[model samples]
Target: MEFDGKTFLTALGLAFILEGLPYFLLAERMPTVLRFLSERPAPELRRLGLTAILAGLAVVALVRW
Candidate 1:
């Protein structure tokens, strides 16, 4: 499929909304959650991040296929 600026922008906007939703809905608990994450080991965080990246890529690949 051809690249489209509007579709790209829409996807980015949706990502932003999803990223912000947790913070907006759980404003009070966010600080504690952030602190918990901050205290996690670097290796663990890296693994979690890598997992998320792979999961997102898999979803995109499935959608494109």
Candidate 2:
């Protein structure tokens, strides 16, 4: 699939809204993301993975928005 810059950004913004929606509605049963962040003993791998996720999301958001 190929999308121009603006189309890519709109799709990305929708994705973030969708992903964050579940967590917003299910705060009591937080996703692994939340749990890992709260854990005092989080592993290095977990931090790296989370950083990648956030960075990727940021790029998509900026590009598409």
TM-score of each: 0.86, 0.42
Look at candidate 1 and give me any clashing residue pairs: none
Best lDDT among the predictions, by candidate number: 1
Question: Against the unseen true structure, what C-alpha lDDT does each candidate score?
Answer: 0.97, 0.81
lDDT of 2 by residue, 2-60 (tens): 75899779978998998898788887778676776666565876887899899988997
Model 1 lowest lDDT segment of ten: 1-10
What is candidate 1's lDDT per residue for 18-42, written digit by digit as tens? 9999899999999999999999999
| Residue 25, model 1, lDDT | 100
What C-alpha RMSD separates each model from the true structure? 1.4, 7.6
Q: Tally clashing residue pairs in candidate 2.
A: 1
